[model samples]
Target: MPAVTEPKLIAGNANLSLAKAIARRMSMHRGMSVSLVEARVERFNDQEIFVEVFENVRGEDMYIIQSTSNPANDNLMELLIMTDALRRSSASRITAVIPYFGYARQDRRAKARTPITAKLVANMIAEAGVDRVLTLDLHAAQIQGFFDIPVDNLYASPVFALDIEHQFRGQMNDLMVVSPDVGGVARARELAKRINAPLAIVDKRREKAGEIAGMTVIGDVRGHKCIIVDDICDTAGTLCKAAETLMEAGATEVHSYITHGVLSGPAVERVQNSVMKSLVITDSIEATEKVKAAGNIRIVPTAPMFAQAILNIWGGMSVSSLFETDTLVPIYEGLYQRS
Candidate 1:
């Protein structure tokens, strides 16, 4: 269709801070005056969601920044309703920039009669009139296939790598990257390779969701400072146990860098009392007061990286190149300075 002047950024109630941060970073690019769309996303007394766009978005490219985090259904509905509003307003294209895609843990059917809710959520978004999707560190990469539209899955590895470099500058040789479970070995390996450190795995048996039966270390962690890498930290049960296991296995220290910090239930208390020295997470999900007050927990902003991704998408450039060594180094440095 028609050429648009600049990207229209929209925000929902899920993560307003992140949306504002993204808007600021986008404004920094090309000296463009970018700001979030003035939309009223409210709820009725009965808890029904309502949306109203105050400004004209007709023939404009729209990006809605919302993370389906806590109260996943509510935030998800906000995104879908916003998408429908943009479509009806005749917006050229609508992209849902979901920093954290909740209900992603139910991506597959692990047992009989279980629903694959991830696919259902994907279908809902596609049907709601979103032209594309942009999310970070999906629980399962294959969830991209569930969406018929273009999907951009960005990683927090580059951000974590930079922080790791800065935090463990001279102790690189004694550093070890760890996967808390077998499934996350690949994720942990990537970070290990980035920092030129060794990789380790905590082999654990799960009796049920959120419960670990037994755990054992697969690689030698003796005399090394361990860094556990994973996609999501929901309850912090497995994560805390893994840290304890690593410490008992002769590891000098244990630290973790997880992308999405769902931190449900007793996660904060567990982390505060755990053996891990620190826990670094991205601002994919808005931090709760408990999480913010936790001494060991630190958040790195994903705004600059996401802004670059949006800029590239609007410019029709390659999104995958954002993770390149040369490209990410600057991103990491910027994140370092911001933190």
Candidate 2:
């Protein structure tokens, strides 16, 4: 009889570095040396996806990590194919670990006759035989309802809160969290609550896709260093424009902590030229060379968070408690410059 093993970690080509990071974190937990499962994912001459799992996953749980990022279609197809392969291999369960879920921005239809692509993707994953999903900071929370399988949606707030504590330790109260637009006010408000900072909103209009018409600062940002919080920063147009508007409205400086940095098209250039003091993003999506070249950008690792969630799920524990620290102290404990 073959010896039993814990869950196996597999990686698709989308974000191999993140997968390795997650494996390393898990190894620390297991107190032993372990690595990704032997799997081959490649394409044929016609660009057709091919997947073959070398290790015996029979009766073993599987977590396949793949971010549907740039070249989104190809990456997404790889994930679906891997899921199918694992299922057929007699794996007890297959979890799709999608750090950056693509088509998530199209969760709903803004115009008539447009498809709800997010829901469609969810259906595809479910149909592909995935038992569950593990992802971070989905563009819209409602997208979770699109799937019938168990979906674990993790937040990058804990990671951001820790950084916020370290970066603005002495000036917590004077730091304000601003939403780049009205739609993200709730996200900004939550971050503000976490750090005990004030909340502000940028009243902006979206005249067309990927464009912001104008914005007005709804709250006082004067003399305060502001941090804008949002779920995604694709083109950086909204964030750059918001930073300029905040500075014009008397903000001392402007920064941003966005969960997913799609950073497509002219995003890197815009952020480099923008007045924003810094732009912090999670490594949910692989950062491009241009994003790395941008001087003001910082990346926070999410692998540990994902690794912990995976452990909790495999152990049948609640994943929500990971956000809370051991001291039972409020996440906002810090000296206040305002006081």
Candidate 3:
């Protein structure tokens, strides 16, 4: 095989806007002029995904930017088929850059006769001929083990921390990070430590997924500006309820910083009517019009960080350095200041 020179970005329909943003950000980095590969990812009359690479990809480093988000099955299939196409085209390396990896919440079998869909998705991606995987804020960190290829699981905490600082700059003294459930204590605690704030947990009894039976605050949130941290926000039922519970526990104001805004059924409506002051999410999953229209929802762009990660991977640099708070704070601060 010949030496791979530059990274070629290929995007599926899952999140085209984010892909473009990543390309644009990459171009801005130290005169590295990167652009998306000329490819067609369309569908046939039977809804079968068809992918064609217009440019020569032989021996090139290819990064497929596709999130397995809404219409999960279709987007996932597009990724698989695109990987197969690239492998057949003799690409030297193929990396799947999935910003919002769907089926991540199903990492384990919670009940008998159920399958671990997360592992299944990982297996499918590997079998499709991807040499590496880059994804953000997986629902369960252990999902990395499911992949045979090298996996880089990036966190949104550094990005979220900077936004929280900018938004609650003056009120940091009275800020508290709240985990919506017991399972998310580590995530919330990390953010709390980043901002030098206290941490709290919302102990909830989930009778089933998306349904909260009851919830109680594990720590005192009295007069504090509470921020809930979680990975995915699907229906927003639990998020809204957690905000209300925090208020009842004497919280002055409530906000949320979730990684993936998988705002499915009634999520926007619920957020609009909830007691939360704001719900900040990343551009991992493309925002819907309803989400864009929501008064309390804000989206922090993750493009610069991802673009840097791609560059580091291509240059054989340290990707873990991007995870440090000091490293990303300036990048995010500059991004927010520009906008």
- Estimate the overall C-alpha local distance difference test score of candidate 2: 0.87
Better candidate number, 1 or 2, judged by lDDT: 1
Residue 88 displacement (Å), model 3: 0.7
Off by over 4 Å in 3: 1-4, 30-32, 207-210, 336-339
C-alpha root-mean-square deviation, each candidate: 1.9, 3.8, 2.0
- Clashing residue pairs in candidate 1, if any? none
Q: Which ten residues in a row have the lowest lDDT in candidate 1?
A: 330-339
Taking the tens digit of each residue's C-alpha lDDT, what string does model 1 give over 1-339? 323568889999999999999998888875978989998999999999999999999889899999999899999999999999999999988999999999998999999999999999999999999999999999989999999999999998978888887788778899999999999999999889888999999999979875778999999999999999999999999999999999999999999999999999999999999999999999999999999999999998899889999988887888999775558666545545423
Model 2 vs. true fold: TM: 0.94
Residue-by-residue lDDT tens digits, candidate 3, 1-339: 323498889999999999999999888874877889999999999988899999999999999999999899999999999999999999999999999999998999888999999999999999999999999999989999999899998999988887877777677898999999889999988888888999999999878775678999999999999999999999999899999999999999999999999999999999999999899999999999989999999999999899999988998888899888778866555554312
Lowest lDDT block of 10, candidate 3: 330-339
Write down the worst ten-residue block by lDDT for model 2.
Answer: 328-337
Please give, for residues 1-339, the per-residue lDDT of candidate 2 as tens digits: 222558789999999999999999888877886699999999999999999999899899899999999999999999999999999899998899999999998988888999999999999999999999999988888899999998989877767877787787778878999998778877788788788888999998878876677899999999999999999998888789999999999999999999999999999989989999899999999888878888999998887788888888888888787665422123223421122
